[model samples]
Target: MRKRGKYIIDKRMKFKRGYQRKMILKIKNDNNLTWKNLADEFDVSIQTVMNDWGREFATIPYSLGIRMIDKYLSKEKNLILSYWISEILPKKWGQFLAGELNKKKIKIPQESEGLAELIAVILGDGHLERKTLTMTGNFFEREHHKYIETLVNELFGLSAYNIKLKGSNALQTKFHSTELIDFLIKNGLVLGNKITNKARIPEWIFSKREFMLAALRGLFDTDGGIYNKQKGYKRALIEFQTHSPFIRDNTIKLLQRTGFTPSKSASNNSSIGCTLACNTRIQNQKEIHKFFNVVGSANPKNILRYKYFLKRGEIPLKDKIYKEICRIKIIRPFKRL
Candidate 1:
């Protein structure tokens, strides 16, 4: 569900009891104010101020402390607040503050090839939460995750941190920024449940051929895969799968627009999801080549498979494919179109 209302700092900030008492006394004397006056000034009850001054409470909320520093104390006396904000705040609070403060530093990307590609990547393997943007992959795709980190940094001017899931093979690349999420929503992306929200390609992306191709590249790289139809088949079949009928239908239209005859079929599972396949045949080899030549892949796994097929005229067995990929020395880095 979407979060409502403006953001607020609900967490408390710790201060030494002695320091709290000292600040209350100093502010009261300097301004000739009583406890009630101070309470009114800080927008708190009289008992709240008295308890803080009496050291009855070891901490004050972030909102109260910040008001005291900003409104009551002079610049020279604000060092304590600065230190607490920088070094003593809880890690989650610190991250929240940093994200809010750094909002201005985030770059609003123009509609371009890179932006289209990022949108597709998000639709494939990313999620937009209330306060964060996250892209996840298998642990073995560390190199691909690094590429995504760089892509996000280049496009948004924000750094993405990686988290490896405990007892699992998943790795998450995430950044905190509600502003980025808002921008993405404005560009046709959805927060929370994507399939429930019916997320699909933005209309603007279909306005240009370059944008469509870039979006295709990102979607296929993240969610698509390639394999031989039979054990000894000489041709390869590339497939893109998704649970969203909106995405599946749109992807079929996209493949058709790009000059490929893609076959769509429903999954046998009860999930009602579907897959789109581009099969390489004597008559359709040119179309398969066209897919790679224009809407190429960024994933090393797909790249290795395509390369192996090109060299040997067919894809190898699963065991051999894994060994060959591990042995390959160079994995091409992603480049913006």
Candidate 2:
């Protein structure tokens, strides 16, 4: 006997009340769906749908409950409709708009150093949506884009294609296989509306030094930026910023573990989540050398900054490229203190 409550059903019902409540909520949340359509899908009368939601006496077969859950999980228009397969379906559908679900989990290359780096890159600039996985960069960051594309292919065995955003100078590499999407979701990357959900570094990735270093390299190259606060001095600051506290805290810890001392701060106001930042100054020549050798940047912008710092000992304020970065920083809220 289950507990009697708002979503509770009478013992007479075949389906649990809690399960019914979840199904009802899912239906209500989807703006395009209607109870009538759902009733038709389950081969039940519309009155049964009303009864299930309103605490009236309602009973549904176990098979119907499973189909309801599956429908809630999938997009209806994308379903593979077959006349022979009637309203009743398997617990899990064989196909969707994106592709068939690959139930087998892809082993996150736990032994490879590059795998950690790829994960970090995704955490920094990747969007793991339900139908696609994408990594984006400025149009000029061709090398960085290529690096990300190579990693995606090597790791997932799926080739990512470059897409230029309409009316924008951003370049994107997208992987559209549902199999890959499922594999990534199983490995801890959240799919769909990730900004609010906040993806973080998996604990397993932190188990090895090589993996950690590579991950940091990917993150810094994408999300981390370098700038010279002083006009003519050799001083440069490296900062990593994200709205996810999980990523922020873990990043700080990773930096500390790598023998670099860093300080963290949070923004007072941000719409999605508080902006968390960790930063450090290039204290000496040795520190700069270590950063390049151990945790090198993949982004062309950061790479250029690093090279300029090495040759000139400081980023020139008059340099057109650095000026562009600073100009964008002025306008972008992400760089705001």
Candidate 3:
């Protein structure tokens, strides 16, 4: 059963209780209007104006308040809007709007290793909608999601909200900011469907080896997987697979440029929309070790799998892998950059 609660707006957009009453009375006197007149102006019921606003029984919606200020108090509109933003809106919403109103006040970080990694993460598992940036991952990698939350906060001064998908083992971290979206687009990320846009690594990332490596780490952590090749063979394989040929080709080039020999393959199956799986793999055990040592992994699942492979010379079943990870403490918290 669903529990009843206050309206979402009432909880999200808070203001002093009697504020509506005070504003309604002032507007009535200054405009020489009756309760009916105000209700007609706002297309609301007379009871809504008199009982709700006049008797201080309910708070006015922000949109209604803005309309009142604009139509009746044009001279003080700016002042009143400022008051609404600073005093009525939630603190986080107010701060976000304030930053948007004055872009200079927003601290958009310059190019750095952290930023590069973020770009790769977005490329690997993120989606850019109209005004939101969302990244989804397996629920088993909750620790990695926490790390991404911290990384986003440290880099962009924005808080990411997590939502667990119903009926699935997936978790999503999402935030909405047009400025942030524009910043990402300016930094080479496409705004719509990435596969359609043919998204590739930003050229500037190649300018620095550290930036490239950080990006590689982000990509591998999000999209790459590691496991033993065969039940009897003591060999591990690190592989990255994507539907975007551009991304797969670029990833192979990136691995090669980073001094690792990576093999590539592709397969197409019409059963699943005929999407081609563009795959790149580093099959050499020595290179896999070097990949972990240099590029590293942010996802605890991947790290645990690699550690288990190193220790036992083979990967175990899913449940056993989970049990193994739980037995030892291996997740490294993300550090601020």
Q: Judged by lDDT, which candidate is best?
A: 3
lDDT of 3 by residue, 1-337 (tens): 1111112232132445555566678899998999779877876555456654576544566666777878888887775555543356553453466655324323598889888888989999887643567788877777777777777788888877787765678788876676778788888787545776667788888888888888888888888888778779999899997888878877887888889999988786332221768888999878988888778888777777777787888877555667554444434522212
Which prediction has more favorable lDDT, 1 or 2? 1
The residue pairs found clashing in candidate 1 are: none
* Model 2, span 1-337: residue lDDT tens: 2211112221222334354445465665664657677656655434346443423233444444446646565554233222112343222233332233334334344447777887788888887644457777777665677777777767766666786755777777877666677666665577534456666777777788877888788778777877775677787777787766667777877887887777767764454556444333444446556767777766657766766787887764324684444332211111111
Looking at model 1, which ten-residue stretch has the lowest summed lDDT? 274-283
- Candidate 1 vs candidate 2: the TM-score winner is 1
- The superposed Cα distance between candidate 1 and the true structure at residue 287, in angstroms, equals 1.8
What lDDT tens digits, residue by residue, belong to model 1 across residues 179-296? 8888898998887556657778999988888888888887887777767755666777787877777777777777777778887666443333433332222126666667788887
Least accurate 10 contiguous residues by lDDT in model 3: 1-10
**Over 4 Å off, model 3:** 1-105, 268-274, 323-337
| Candidate 1 lDDT score at position 124 | 88
TM-score ranking, best first: 3, 1, 2
TM-score of 2: 0.61
Candidates in order, TM-scores: namely 0.65, 0.61, 0.65
